[model samples]
Target: MKRFALIFLFTFLLSPKIYSQRCGGGILTFNIYTLNGEDIKEFDYEIFPVSKELLQKNLYEKVVNEQNMNNSDYPLFKSVETSGRIIGKVFVDQIIDNNNPKLNAKLQELLDTSAITQKGTITSTLLFSTRENQSFPIVLKISNGDREVYILGNYFGNCDREASLVWGDKVLKLE
Candidate 1:
């Protein structure tokens, strides 16, 4: 009985750390961005907290890492951080609109959702964007069965009037 108890205790203690969270295919701990800087104040984009579980199941459109960002050594990123334990990123982009108030409200809503919905697998997620002069956030968070997707901005691509192709207020306007 003593030996069995010791084994059970050891396993219980070891499991959380081992399974708490991890990236898939060595893609853990990375970031994405729109402004191409190291901090949030300089960025014009929002972040998406990706899940390691999504990576494990091979459900992401892109996968990046700290090494990749550092290796490329791009100078314009505004802010960068890991989405979670997996190989995903939450990068600040240039589409943020500082001149609009309604945009602010939508952003607050999106931030609220991202903060509350993050759980295991992260199978579904939302990315947020806002224009400086707009009245509403172009994208919204919704259930798409199993995968989460950003539902605003450009339905096909980054809309210049809605979402800046470049994440900075100074980026060249897409013509």
Candidate 2:
């Protein structure tokens, strides 16, 4: 019984560190708001660390599917290229190494809401290429990097569902 208790305690103590190591060096949150500026819902989207190549491939596939290309077209090609440039270029490092033991404290600071919203030293900005009309407005927050950069994006209802980053908070505007 004593041995079992010791093992349990050890696991409990080590789990947080183990879990933190798996973090993809970034976090995203979605906030939903009404037209009147009332917050309706908020949730976290667990973004996985991925290589730039993988992100490009995924973005290409997403554009292809959404455009429903029956034939090769210049417009479609341009759209795909633009989307890749916007998202892929902006995030120079898609998968940050949060597992670095030296950066543990920094990662924790990056994940802190107050630190990000108020005291964050890094300049935060929102960048998106395509604009679409929607019934409701969605807000997305992305936190990443050792120095921590936050990205805010406005998602237009169903149109952005396919392109929106999965690991972050997603706020959907309700009709």
Candidate 3:
């Protein structure tokens, strides 16, 4: 009994540190806007957290190993600490006459459903933008406390004028 209790306690103590490698458990808000800087839509999402190191590895593989952009050391290939984590905010390209509550509710419903399909504890989102040429047309930056990685890819490929839900590496187009 004593050995079993000790083992259990040890495992419990180390579990969180072991699992701190990925980010999840945060409600991310995406505020959509038009080119003219008018906010049109906003929604929240909860993506199942993935290991930051794993994500960075996957991204590096996607960009360099798979895409064959190995001529030089790609910037995103840097290592993510075991405590790697990220927060998200999204924006879209569209215009609306007004912010409609009914439409917003519908969009929220869609996001809820989408989150149910994928599945953290982060609060308060930040929103900002950079020169179009400096960033991807649709950018999702995952900033670990130490490093910030701008995920490069068309996660919004077919979701133009529509909503997109990113569950880990899977991108779902919500029409």
Give each model a TM-score: 0.18, 0.22, 0.22
Model 1: how far is 97 from its true place, Å?
2.2
Those runs of model 2 whose alpha carbons end farther than 4 Å from true positions after fitting are 1-32, 35-50, 61-114, 117-175
Q: What C-alpha lDDT do the candidate models reach, one value each?
A: 0.30, 0.33, 0.31
lDDT of 3 at 54: 40
Question: Model 2, poorest ten-residue lDDT window?
Answer: 130-139
lDDT of 1 by residue, 68-138 (tens): 54342332121111121111113212223344565455445645533432222222222423222222222
Each model's Cα RMSD: 16.7, 19.6, 16.4
* Model 3: number of backbone collisions: 5
Clashes of each: 20, 10, 5
Q: lDDT tens digits, residues 70-94, model 3?
A: 4334433211111112223221112
Query: Best lDDT goes to which candidate?
Result: 2
Question: Relative to the unseen true structure, what is the C-alpha lDDT of residue 72 in candidate 1, on a scale of 0 to 100?
Answer: 26
Candidate 1 deviation (Cα RMSD): 16.7
Candidate 2 — what's its lDDT? 0.33
